[model samples]
Target: MKYINKKIIFTFLLVLLMNGCLGIIPNKDSVTRKDTTTNIESSIYKKYNRHTDTTYYSHNNLFGKNISIYWTKKKKEKSYARIKFSYLGSRWIFFNEVTLVNAAGSRISFHIKSTDISTNVVSDRIVSEKANFLLSKVDIISLKKLFNSPSVDLRLSGKSHKDYALSESEIKSLFEILSYNP
Candidate 1:
């Protein structure tokens, strides 16, 4: 009975190893970060699971004084890109829309899915708002077009609006952040 039990345990471990359920082996995905010359910072990293044949992409961007952004997608989720915008402010702005303007004066719009607000009590009271945005395939294509433009500007709107024109360095960082592929 002891010999049979040991054989069963060995078989289970071998099966787990073969199926990558053991989680002991290192993954082969390479993560790359681009050098930024400007105050704006951005990076994209990919994590690939060989056993399940799935790729996960992580994109992070930090803009000016108060806005930070992260975009992510899994390989199987072809139609949607999940993006979160974290804004630090005194009160909720309730951002609902984002517009991208290329150098040619053309504009593309993305509708934000939702916004959530919270307050933090620190040395100074500050309100933090997180806006969730979902980009469809069409929006992604429009973003690609903006990436090729000489300059880009971002306009975010809700109860209030904020506009930012990308500097050369910021534009370069945004380009690099969006260029990553699985």
Candidate 2:
């Protein structure tokens, strides 16, 4: 009987691993400063088993500031690219000052019509912008040559004074993070 119970437990663990039932949940805290994840939405993370590999890149024009970016997929129907900007001195992601150009040569502007914003002070007030603009697939054939190469120049242009671009490594990491199925 004891042997049978042990086997059952092993089987259960295997199933959980295979189905991705064991994953860190994505939440506001997941992308926040390097501490205090108390505000995380554990229920959603428990339900979906999201992979919590967040990518960080330094912000342009903001000294000593880095932006945290992460990807999330809900019910396999909605995919999101969340970008958070914060600084200790004085800098924030002004909605009108940011623009994103995808690999398809499409220039998309940030829409402030409706979004969920939460304020908490850990390192600084993080301005999070979760957009579904990256939900669909894009033509990455043009990026094959630039794969994992951090020699390309990417600049952000719009109504914002800040400046930053995805390094080659960052672009590769972005692709890897978004390649998730769930």
lDDT of each: 0.52, 0.36
lDDT of 2 by residue, 18-116 (tens): 323453333332322222133222211222353644322221211222233344554525555445443221233333333445455544344433343
Candidate 2 accuracy as TM-score = 0.35
Checking candidate 2 for backbone clashes, the offending pairs are 25-45
Candidate 2: which stretches are off by over 4 Å? 1-89, 101-108, 114-134, 137-160
Residue 75 CA displacement from its true place in model 1, Å: 7.8
- Which sections of candidate 1 miss by over 4 Å? 1-43, 46-56, 59-80, 113-124
Candidate 1 matches the true fold with a TM-score of 0.53
The 10 consecutive residues of candidate 1 with the worst lDDT sum are 24-33
User: What's the TM-score of every candidate structure?
Assistant: 0.53, 0.35
- For residue 100, give model 2's deviation from the true position in Å: 3.0
Clashes in each model (backbone N, CA, C under 3 Å)?
0, 1
